[model samples]
Target: MGANATTLHPNVASGGAYDHMKLNNGIKYSFTYELRPGSGSSWGFELPENQIAPTIEETFASLWKFAEEIYADDNATGRK
Candidate 1:
């Protein structure tokens, strides 16, 4: 897998870090996710590509769901 491509390994870290592992073999799927650092007391988001919301949504929804767990509600919420 390349830095810019993977079935896993979204930028799942925010104000933190972790490891991503993919065990399923031959399961080729494209997934995308965005992790914004939300400690600036500003609006933040963890969207899966807004331009093609549906495509990105469908592909990465599962990964995004688990990824979000690492970030606390406030960190991801962008609350001031």
Candidate 2:
């Protein structure tokens, strides 16, 4: 993936797994989560009050899954 696209779906940024996407309405928002058991044990997906968790949940989950499918078993970190 290109640098811009990869940055848009960050699994670690600014000390967290932060990500951002643009909505159809032209509004932009960001979310962050955790996957390892280092500082915490929660996969936090911060969203607007009116938003749902499933969207971010699936996004992060699918990102990893997609990486697994495209990379070798020993180097499947979903990272380009």
Candidate 3:
């Protein structure tokens, strides 16, 4: 995917489900994604219909990469 990626550390505490799962369930591999239209677009959640397919494709690519890395790490560490 050709999307720009950055790490966001918000000042405010978001008591979202990801936080709950990580804090309570000991799930270390957790994430929260904020999907928006590509760089110069004025759209937020109101993504244009034409942009939907590309967004989904990019999201799937990123997810696949993440999964691949995790699987590789598990195999290297002999984790099931």
Best by TM-score: 3
| Candidate 1 Cα errors over 4 Å, as ranges | 1-23, 35-41, 46-80
Please provide, for model 3 over 1-80, each residue's C-alpha lDDT reduced to its tens digit, 9 standing for 90 to 100.
Answer: 11112234344444567666766798757786667664567786898899889889989999999999999998999988
Pairs that collide in candidate 2 are: none
What lDDT score belongs to each candidate, Candidate 1 first? 0.43, 0.45, 0.71
* TM-score against truth, every candidate: 0.21, 0.27, 0.69
Q: Tell me the lDDT of model 1 at 74.
A: 41
Residue-level error in angstroms, candidate 3, position 20: 3.4
The candidate, 2 or 3, that scores higher on lDDT is 3
Q: Kindly list the per-residue Cα lDDT of model 2 for residues 13-78, writing each as its tens digit.
A: 432322223323332333333333235435444444444565567667877876666576435655
Worst 10 residues of 3 by lDDT: 1-10
Poorly placed runs, candidate 2 (over 4 Å):
1-50, 73-80
Q: How many backbone clashes does candidate 2 have?
A: 0
**Model 1 — which ten-residue stretch has the worst lDDT?**
13-22
